[model samples]
Target chain A: MERKRASLKFLVTVMSNQAASTPAALKHTPLNATHRELSAKMVDFGGWDMPVNYGSQIEEHHVVRTGCGLFDVSHMLPLDIKGANVRAFLKRLVANNVDKLQVSGKALYSCMLNEAGGVIDDLIIYFMDESWFRLVVNAGTAEKDLAWMEKMNADWDMGLTLTPRRDLAMIAIQGPNATQALNHALPGVDSITAHLKPFNAAAMGEMFIARTGYTGEDGYEVMVLAKSAPFFWKALMEAGGKPIGLGARDTLRLEAGMNLYGQDMDETTSPLESGLAWTVDMKTERDFVGRAALEKSEITQQLVGLLLLDKGVLRGHQKVLTKHGEGEITSGTFSPTMQQSIALARIPLGIAPGEEVEVEIRDKKLKAKVVKYPFVRNGKVLI
Target chain B: MSIPADLKYTPSHEWVRVEADGTLTVGITHHAQDLLGDMVFIENPATGRSLAKGEECAVVESVKAASDVYAPVAGEVISANADVESSPEAINKDAYSAWMFKLKPANAADVAGLMDAAAYQKLVESEAH
Candidate 1:
């Protein structure tokens, strides 16, 4: 009502987070050698020197959308928590219910939280068993998540070992032909991962195969020994996996309507207002970290999916206006699948999925329609 | 890729070919298409639209991001390439040949102010360093 929109207090974390940005103690995945061979443009992302692009990023995007593109996602940290009461500790540590992950190897996407109910990070937790759980969190949040988990694990008397798997590297091969490429790339991998359902994972020695991805496609997020990453990458490339960059990775995930940990929702925002209300199980009696804050607070706005019908691309931090109120785009991009611009905006409630809103692109306000997120999936347009 | 020796260029990265008809064909240079990545959508000025030098007359969106193509000189759009809008990737495939629009220059002599391919090549090289 006052002014409809502004950047959700993300700057505080990004600003105060001047934690030694130096290259000290930095590590690399095995693909680091292969990326150099391809002459990639490397940049420091969350302390890992990763390739931003090989050469042509747009072509790489198309390669993934139309065929297959492989991404070096080893920067994301995987933490394995073990010992008894692991499930009980996680139920209190995260905003999402751990009870939903009843089946073995089933993964649940959730937001890790601090005591104040603010999001510490968003992660995917694989429920392997009562004694074991694995969490894949953002690269930037690795240190913070480990610290938080360690302190809490000790405080709660949970005999959990928060082991960071530095020995591992991850590769995400996504697009229409994703599954086929991976199946053919790694010898004996298909037989193990051939029947894996969505969000299901299987471990084969040092390699862990998960049928999940940020891209709106049927793909595998394969984690393997850091030493074997280069060989696997080469094999996958020879088997027809075109190497993609972080640029395409952003577009792919944006089009897929997935929330980036820091960009879309952070410590200042709640899962309810961040379009992740469905991920929170209010129906269950279980009380998680952020439950009280979410329960007591009056949610003023909600996150929604948008499709730009105008001539410009919608970008993050851009303002969104509706008759109900104004909001801001958290993540936006020109969708390869839709061939139009799309975004995820936090707008006031009552702006339902079929409504129209205006996005301030440059100086002009362009029309955009609120649609269900996930502009594409499995090479098909859903919006 | 080598920049052609004869064509004129702009900092925004469009290449202009002056024809005997005093008309000009404009397209983004190879360097631009390479930097921008896979072309997905293109919007050119209408045939009759008048534009000032440095005005945004066309828009090009790659899989990575969107960029504006400016009118290199004051001119009236004489023709627009519809084929490019239909198959935007053609620009990435061959940027020089995928001409975006044609313009009848406000003054044919103003082309002298733009960079020749040799100078533009040096500009591109310097920017890279």
Candidate 2:
């Protein structure tokens, strides 16, 4: 398997000399100082100085799954689109049908694709009105997504105003007790958020709280003004909400069967082969950017889940030895919830669940089992 | 940061306990576990395996990544700690007490070449800056 050179791989390497020489070159989130005060281990995550963990990543993962944990996800950008032709523009821009989001606070997950049926970025769109839609995009791909959208807007003459909300800071409070913790942290929020369902959001004062999270847990992704973030983070911590970092976030998302954009699927791979075919709307005849290419191409590989039966931790770039052919692990981690190593591998078709495969870890070939994932959900092990 | 004064140390962060039998019990220091985070898996060298000084013999994996645990000095592996391999979190809980492997040193004088607590502490402080 070919290992892609990304920040995730270098998380373990200590670059003390480089950090000393150019400390100011890295970008900081609003809670950077607070993270340092909390003694978080900060790392360079896609040029952003983000916390990998405050203490134990496994503890943070358990806290998010069992109790309450807060994550400073401000690195993710929220873009606001406003125009009379917004809905029409979205239909052509995204691979999923935006019309499905009828309720004002409802959200839809979609992949923004390139012309050759490859994924550009996977984002969440919140429908606020006929003319305005809010999009939350990944941190590393925010600028690239904006550039592509701008080029498309110019070509289509949509007259839409794309406003990137860099002035906001996002905090994800997740767990089974997340709602109660949020109530403890920011009293009287339940009045506005009590009835909120999955994929729904509400505006309370200046904060936009969404009942959504990357971790497979009940939580809210609250976006507040950048200046108010530190105070919000402090309040949450005071309410017994542990501060979780990106290390736990990666493991949580991987166990939840969610794809990491750069690791799982990128500009070179389409959603069909990336275990995201359900999100790609093909039932109705709507021509999106990559629709024609997807129709013309043949999908040969499939993304599936793996459970290591042996005693080693599964990791990205490991080669998979399947009966049909060779495959590569896209995202892998030791699942704190499952107490075992789990991963998502792109393998050939016809590989069914319950089948055994071998993953080459270092010099040893470890036994593993193919399984359907979301290996964990809502603090419970599924497969 | 708790480097027991009596125990010897290696620059790579392994701590050694000189048993009554002159055999050495070795484990990664507390600082090593702090940097590596919670231990999820550990692969120790076989009991009979012989090792050279500074040879990478065992593997220790945390949730974030894996690391190599090297042999502190030239020695034959006297015994491996089975407790650590099955329950790796013991190392995170008490790094000093949860030993990884015991080694029978080729020469007792080789342990003298390793760092003392005071010298290892100085090396750690320098790395911090």
Identify the leading candidate in terms of TM-score.
2
Query: Residues B87-126, candidate 2, lDDT per residue (tens digit)?
Result: 9999999999999999999999899999999998887666
What residue pairs clash in candidate 2, if any at all? none
The local lDDT score (0 to 100) that residue A184 gets in candidate 2 is: 85
Q: Alpha-carbon error at A126 in model 2, in Å?
A: 0.8
Residue lDDT tens for model 2, A91-171: 999999998999999999999999999999999999999999999999999999999998999899999999999999999
lDDT of 2 at A321: 97
Tell me candidate 2's fraction of native contacts, as a decimal between 0 and 1.
0.29
Question: Candidate 1, A250: how far from true, in Å?
Answer: 3.0
Task: Please give the range of 10 consecutive residues that has the lowest summed lDDT in model 1 chain A.
Answer: A6-15
Docking class of 2: acceptable
Error of 1 at A282 (Å): 3.0
List candidate 2 segments past 4 Å from native: A1-23
